[model samples]
Target: MQRMIEFPTAFWVSQYTIRFAFQEEISAENSRNVRLFRTFLQQALSADLLEVVASYATVTAYVKRKVALQPLREQWYAQQASIEVSVSHTPIQIPLCYDEEFALDMQRVMDYTGLAYEQIKQLHLAKVYRVYVIGFLPGFPYLGELAEALFVPRLAKPRQRVAASSVGIGGAQTGIYPLDSPGGWNIIGKTPLKLFQMQRAQPFLLDVGDCIQFYEITKAEFRQMEVNSY
Candidate 1:
């Protein structure tokens, strides 16, 4: 984050949208650019901006068919590299109950990773994972780059209904199921915290570029906590 450098990127445009693809590998540097671009976008774009989304390595700007986009493109080139709006790297702790009652598929995860329960738990809590993007479900954070030893494949068939706050991993990424929704991520734990609340000013608990740290909790504690987890 100390680097006051302008990272390289490629700009692509089509009839309805423009995309700025970060050319380098995903890192804190690229994440900073995304933060800056997101901030600039909100301040620069008006109703002409139909929709905007930032991904792991790209920012997509959607616009109406009749809107001319050259001006907005200029705005990006002028200030997209600024880091004034960079997100805080502070790690937010999420309490997870890994007890069998909540850890729906612990045995499966251990069998696939060839790891003991302690190893799996420690490895996940070892590093503060960065949120690369938010998608798949409302307030569902796509957090990443799991330890190679923790790598596992998705279930052959997706689950019909997963409980909200259920923490799971598929392939190389991990995430929470905000609401009881169909998903394929192998469930290993559940969080007591409310990840999304529609009535709150900021509905989502985690944002792109924010860091997450998971800590263990007991089933009793999970139940003791109030239902309003916001």
Candidate 2:
């Protein structure tokens, strides 16, 4: 049985921003709640609403003035009481290349998690991941809830550059670097899929509520697929 998702608590965080926080662990349900709340908030947006950030457990709205806050707050709760959080989600299959050339820190991750390379890759493919939020970088996704046995900590010294599309695991979460950037997550594999395309109608390929499934592929297959993308 599922517990009802009550309306989240909201408080004024700044003169022009208010944050609505949910009381639930990081799960697909909570992710849906955040997504729904964010979607609902957009309906009440005025010129005063400067920005909105929907995160794992909270939705923060930034407005132009304090006077514009109350009406938005009233609107949010009204929608919260009347809106439905759960929506159908489509699972996306992401092909991953776990070859040594792409998996820079696989050995280190294996050492830390006590998992063999095959075990690690197979385990990763077995579970469905939820897209909790898309932040930290353009089109960068923060997917969550890795199986506990595969949990690994971030590198003590962050790497100067983690190649784009490199799949990495940090603590209990797994994510892909949308573009080449410095990061500390343990690199386990690389995904050939284009997660972010600048010219596309929607710059981001995945949304907050979409599901992700990782599957293994050989280096040759990865190269073959890469050729087709261009």
lDDT of 1 by residue, 1-230 (tens): 44443433545477777776775467766776776676666667666678888877787778665454577666666765563645467789998888887778789999998899989988887777888889989989988868878888998899999999899988888898888999898888999887898888988898887888988888888887636465
Note the residue pairs that clash in candidate 2: none
Candidate models: Cα lDDT each? 0.78, 0.82
Look at candidate 1 and tell me the lDDT of residue 74: 69
Instruction: Please provide, for model 2 over 33-77, each residue's C-alpha lDDT reduced to its tens digit, 9 standing for 90 to 100.
Output: 888777777667756678788888898888787645566566765
Query: On a 0 to 100 scale, what is the lDDT of residue 70 in model 1?
Result: 71
Summing lDDT over every window of 10 consecutive residues in candidate 1, give the lowest-scoring window: 1-10
Candidate 2 ranges with C-alpha deviation above 4 Å: 1-4, 46-48, 64-86
The true-versus-predicted C-alpha distance at residue 73 of model 1, in Å, is 6.7
How well does each candidate superpose onto the true structure, as a TM-score? 0.85, 0.86
**Residue 24's C-alpha lDDT in candidate 1?**
47
